[model samples]
Target: MLHSSHEPTDYQCPFCELLNDQPFSPDNLCAPSDLIYRTPLVAAIMACDGFGNYGGHVMIIPTAHLEALYDLDEQTGSAIMWETKRVALAMKLAWNPAGTSTRQHNEPAGNQHVWHYHQHVFPRYADDELYRQLRHRVSVEDRARKALELRSALFSAEHPYRLTDTDVVR
Candidate 1:
């Protein structure tokens, strides 16, 4: 097992709670409907916070409770990268943004709020200034709607987003 650098002793991981299909916290805005793609090893959900004009960004997380990248296994990491690409492509089909970018934080100094390992996928537009913008909370309703839109693109026949049992991490 890998040691965690920043997880608190009494941490209640919001991502784990969300995966369990329960309210992660009072401030949690994620719901089952926000889940766009899920496999036994990885899942992608719509974020409840958006930066600047980009609402409904995607967060790809490992199903297990690995605290950070230092603790992630190769199998789970591969699954995440696969899902990340699929979600990014789906965002293009769903929103047609200028481009998309991915971000991840590890320790508190790195600005990681959640203890669980996760990667953020943002839809970037011209002059979006994503790094400079403050993240604002997104409504559950809007997140669910965006999840549906992205899910449609993710599962469309033109795209090979579906993961079969063979795709599972061994």
Candidate 2:
């Protein structure tokens, strides 16, 4: 068990509730690809509530149930960041976003609605309202397709990029 004072005794953490269940609700889970990216200590999946920006938006979460960043383990933290960067990179490559944004909220005062610690990675567009953008509710099938696309983008980006004075190629 995660040795954290913030662990909820009243109700289960929604992320922990995922427990790799059948992703029927696209907003709560991914149908086809549950976790697009997974390391030993963490997992990255398309958040069901990515209404703010692009299709490839995702959340990087620790596999264990930790309430806040302070409660997160070093190894889990590293794994989360690694997956976050990969997802952001893949979003850039696949979606051609104007930019990328990463957000993490802590505690009620900090607007952290969920108790589980996670990082949000979204593809920023020129007109995106950032925190003010209205989140679009998407379907499970659509999200699954997007997840597949992100995986492909990450796979394609896996190769090294070498630059020449005249040209750039892998």
Candidate 3:
């Protein structure tokens, strides 16, 4: 269970502090429900509304949180990029959109709320106005259900390896 947020901590960053304070839970360690892909070093999961505007809002985050891209070691950086490509491919396959955009925001000025460095994958479609409007109106329960549905679709036997990384550039 997540710890009480009322307790004050000396840690400077909220994300770092949460990581330090909470007892590690395997479920928490697992990707969020909207997760569509995973690799040994990185995982792609959907972001909550606080993170973005899209319904299929995905984020590729290193299994180990690194505060900033500059803070990432060379190996981790490469791994993140590899995982990102896999995610983009999965998004394209699932949404079949006209295009896709990948983005990363760091620090306060960059509008990063999680503190951990993560890349965003937004799927775009030619006629997606309905999706845009629905994304905004979705309730938390509806989002949770959709996330579960996405997870099942991505991980089913037919697509067992769809999200698995391939020949990541070392």
Candidate 4:
């Protein structure tokens, strides 16, 4: 089924470019090292921008470039949700924040910046002001450090999700 796309005719999807290893553009802040979890169907990467006091938030996206929620398939959506849960669990183990939250935007009116369908997982604290605060670009070093933290917590012996061949990126 052909779905209507909101992107411009010459639009270049940053997520697709990043996933495909296409020519690097400074506009895309995501890096290979920022990937904390990935499978054949989906990937969870550290967002370059962080909200409020938190840094190293994660976004789970489908491996295939589906433009929006309306364009997503069941299998891919399930994969994204699975990764989102794992990332939330990892965040709890890693940071021990008060709680965690997941957010997804659909179109321009919904504040969806990227055309690709993705879900964000954030660690929330009492006064984090996640919605009120502006997003700022986190340092590359900080992102890498947080990625390591999440990766360690995600694959650690204490976590329920073990590193199986099916779940882990090889």
Candidate 5:
């Protein structure tokens, strides 16, 4: 039987395996209150509204806990892509950004923390003031509030995608 909590031994990547073994820490993990929707492949959560002055920031993360893109199997990568599309579609429908920016970074030098592979989806407005200051100005409390708001929005039955437990396939 496949053990849900144990790291896969044949992955070939140690960092990826290490991520699987790491204990779940709330500080390292984004707040659950910020969670919008979840699936076996990924979870969508609000990234905090005041972050870049326009709000509507979302992150899509693979549930498998791979540390970086290189650690994921082809199947997992494909699933993450599909989930990302779903998130982008939901963001566009709900927040209506003038444009959207998707970003991914790896390692400390790359400004990545938490050691998990994730993609950032930002809803951008044309004249947002905080655009240039995003790297330095996002606040945790604001992010938490945004996350809660997003969670409330996504949980509504009228939301486009009805995410369920079965959506998360191993």
Candidate 6:
């Protein structure tokens, strides 16, 4: 659940706080993670409220804080989707779910809760309750572990998103 609002909020935007942090850390859930897989334009992090009933779930967000798809440029959008496809395949490799899906939200009216333009990628099995299950927040350690596994998969697995020869975290 992510949200976008041009209006004001009671407090502050968590994602903004994340983007502003100098040198993000993997252990800090509110900040960016070194464990996250990154392209030049986007970063994919384990969703803080990740799967309770599943594994290998993640959210891809632009490094920049754009409110919605409407605010994104073509290059950044392409990078996000490309990394998304890579992450989806990595999820398949790591978790082996029956299928996968991509989700995004806009305003509070549309079930958008976070408001920083993120895309949710999840693993789905038949008869699974990902949509119906509302209480799936994995422990922080589990999230970090799953993130490591997925990041390793992305680093090693040959994918279309690899445009140039590059090194990645192992």
Better model by lDDT: candidate 1 vs candidate 6: 1
Clashes of each: 0, 2, 0, 0, 3, 4
lDDT computed for candidate 1: 0.83
Q: Largest TM-score belongs to which candidate?
A: 4
For all predicted structures, in order, the TM-scores are 0.89, 0.77, 0.62, 0.92, 0.65, 0.79
Instruction: Give the whole-model CA lDDT for all candidates, comma-separated.
Output: 0.83, 0.69, 0.55, 0.83, 0.59, 0.69
Look at candidate 4 and tell me the lDDT of residue 150. Answer: 91
* Model 1 per-residue lDDT tens digits across residues 8-75: 78777778888877657774556767777678899888998988766779999999999888987899
Comparison by lDDT, 3 against 5, better one: 5
Tens digits of lDDT, candidate 4, 1-170: 54567777777777777677787676776777677767889877888898887777988988888878998788898878878888898889999999999999987887888888889999999988899867899888899899899988888788887555567665
Q: Candidate 6 at 164: error in angstroms?
A: 7.7
Q: Candidate 4 at 16: error in angstroms?
A: 1.9
Where is model 2 more than 4 Å wrong at Cα?
Answer: 1-10, 20-34, 52-56, 157-170
Looking at model 4, which ten-residue stretch has the lowest summed lDDT? 161-170
Give Cα distance to truth, residue 28, candidate 1, Å. 3.0
lDDT of 3 by residue, 18-38 (tens): 223544343232223344445
* 137 Cα displacement, candidate 3 (Å): 7.7
TM-score of model number 3: 0.62
Expressed as tens digits, the lDDT of each residue in 8-80 for candidate 6 is: 5553556556655654334344534523665557777887775445644788888787877777899988978
lDDT (C-alpha) at residue 111 in model 1: 85
Q: Candidate 5 overall Cα lDDT vs. reference?
A: 0.59
Q: Over the full model, what C-alpha lDDT does candidate 6 score relative to the true structure?
A: 0.69
Off by over 4 Å in 4: 1-3
- What is the lDDT for 139 in model 3? 46
Where is the poorest 10-residue window by lDDT in model 6? Answer: 161-170
Is candidate 2 or 5 superior in lDDT? 2
